[model samples]
Target: MSKDINYLIKSSIEIYFKNSQIRDISFNTFLPENRNLKSKRSKLKMEKEGKNNLRFFIESKDITAFRASINEIITFGKIFENVLNLVE
Candidate 1:
């Protein structure tokens, strides 16, 4: 990844929740150098190919509840991204 892009993503993650009370969102960038990226959300797999990808993992057992959660998350995420872009 380009340094600038990586800086932007790390900056976004750091800046987004710095003053918020949210705790469900977290990340890690440390590995032994051989482990592939792995995370579980909604029983699906999210692949990481570059620094520009924004991905999250959510899990739910109930189909209806899961759909509702997905909708809420996506809505909020879009709004948040828009706000971030505006700030830029």
Candidate 2:
């Protein structure tokens, strides 16, 4: 069974991280090809909410990894937000 169904250490979180420039920067900065990421095996689900709005669903079966991944994403988002504020 999948982690979502097994309750065997699963979690998810959503983030905007949508601006085109920010998205490009994040992609380059985060290195999606990295195999060492805690959420490497996790599934990434994304939805386009609007022109520049996106909803990200990060899911993972490894509880520790899941939390760590969320933390990492939050840090990325915080940095993005700070940069966005400066630009705007």
Candidate 3:
């Protein structure tokens, strides 16, 4: 349930990390979330409104976060789940 569900994660990362140049994020191989992100496609909790709410499906996958203690790369694995809450 992670094929399409990943868009949320992707969009969140893309939107949040817009300043960064990381481009290897995807349903197949994303950030620390890939640790157990082996599921299916989905779009269960999207807040699509109006005509946009025409019943759409999103990709799904587990959440990933890494431990980058190198300042710029930084580490946020501790609050990774919290980050997911923000996007989801």
Candidate 4:
């Protein structure tokens, strides 16, 4: 893909993070490890975009795994948001 497409994707994901409040201060401090993993049927990568931004790139061999990964991420985000609310 071109740079513009890449930028667009990153921007969109960042917006989701912003709106979901997933990039809160506490979460940034304990960000996931920045690495890429490949399995027989999928790939997963987590990277820090900048000082306070994280990017997750997940690829699966099939749509089912892809959807599952997405759901898990969304669920994790919701749980984290709730925890932050509780702490504050």
Q: State the C-alpha lDDT per candidate.
A: 0.37, 0.57, 0.29, 0.51
TM-score of candidate 2 to 2 decimals: 0.51
Candidate 2: misplaced stretches above 4 Å?
1-41
RMSD of each: 15.7, 5.1, 14.0, 8.2
Per-residue lDDT of candidate 2, residues 1-88 (tens digit): 4535454344444444546656556555545632345445465554445444445566765666566666766776777678779988
lDDT (Cα, 0-100) at 7 in candidate 1: 17
Please report how far candidate 3 places residue 83 from its true position, in Å. Answer: 9.8
Off by over 4 Å in 4: 1-39
C-alpha lDDT of residue 58 in model 2: 66
Candidate 3 scores a C-alpha RMSD against the true structure in Å of: 14.0
Note the residue pairs that clash in candidate 1: 42-58
Query: How high is each candidate's TM-score?
Result: 0.35, 0.51, 0.20, 0.56
By the lDDT metric, which is better: model 1 or model 4? Answer: 4
Predict model 2's lDDT versus the native.
Answer: 0.57
For candidate 4, write residues 1-88 as lDDT tens digits. Answer: 3323221111113313543245555345334422223354445555556556666677665655566556655665677678868987
Which of 1 and 2 is the better model by lDDT?
2
